[model samples]
Target: MQRYRMALALLGLAWAAGMAHAASEMPVPSALVGAWTLERVDNVYPDGRRVELYGPHPQGLWIIDAQGRYMMQMVRAQRSGFAAGDKSKGTPEEYRAASLDSNAHFGRISADDHTMHTHIEQASFPNWNGKDGNSAYTLKGDELSYVVAKPSSGASEGAHGEVVWRRLP
Candidate 1:
């Protein structure tokens, strides 16, 4: 019966090796490498008010490259309670100021596709600048979620926000 036992052990070893090879050949998902448009943004105010902003207010574009380069652009919506073109027109100085403000909300994904860092150079709300915030991204199936956190100054812990992106065809 020693030969029989040896034959069974060899068969088990062969089966394990075949399973490892199959696992290594598993395919990576293809949904992740493409461009996605921002469909909705829900902002929760500090006073427990939730606002849903939609329509052609502004447009956003996000591109994810297979080589791991990511970029995004978002335009701000026009102010409420005022008709279009009611706000200050674009003078050279006004243009310069708006450009500076636009630069603050942009962000980039790291080369490794693991970290997303956003900088707020100047905030319309008080006391938002001079601080850095980042999110870590995890890929599962076709959805990517980022958990954002900021630094605290002993008063309270930093706030957290989750931004989810769905892969586009």
Candidate 2:
């Protein structure tokens, strides 16, 4: 029994170590060469209604290093302060609020100048774990904008969301 417990513990440690290494190693795509700041994200419906996905002045940043690893984060504007001054001391409501207001993910990417494919290794949103997806993008000067090549479940036919980004120098 003691031997089995020791084996399990070592396996757990090995898995954690593997995850840490994978997080830092990735091949970055050339078209997404720089850091990009989120300008806005909007969901347009077939009925012509436009909805802001993260409130006005939504905050986000995406960075793709030369190695192909990337980290992306987004949050609603003006998130509430955790009253306790300690992140772990926040109330359940505070925790829920924070999760609902933001998202983050990290992974590897492959792209040409027009299309990007992501292999998500980790994500704050659990449902996206181990998922792979792609987007179509366009770059004009300092701006880089992209849209999901396929309609999301919330989108009606012929409707999609657009995420605009500004290239960082």
Note the residue pairs that clash in candidate 1.
none
On TM-score, the candidate that comes out on top is 2
Candidate 1: tens digits of C-alpha lDDT, residues 31-111 = 445776554433434455433333334445667555434455444454333233544645565554444323123222332
Model 1: weakest 10-residue lDDT segment is: 102-111
Candidate 2 residues lying further than 4 Å off, grouped into runs, are: 1-29, 89-92, 149-159
TM-score versus the correct structure, for each prediction: 0.40, 0.72
Which candidate has the highest lDDT of all? 2
lDDT of 1: 0.48
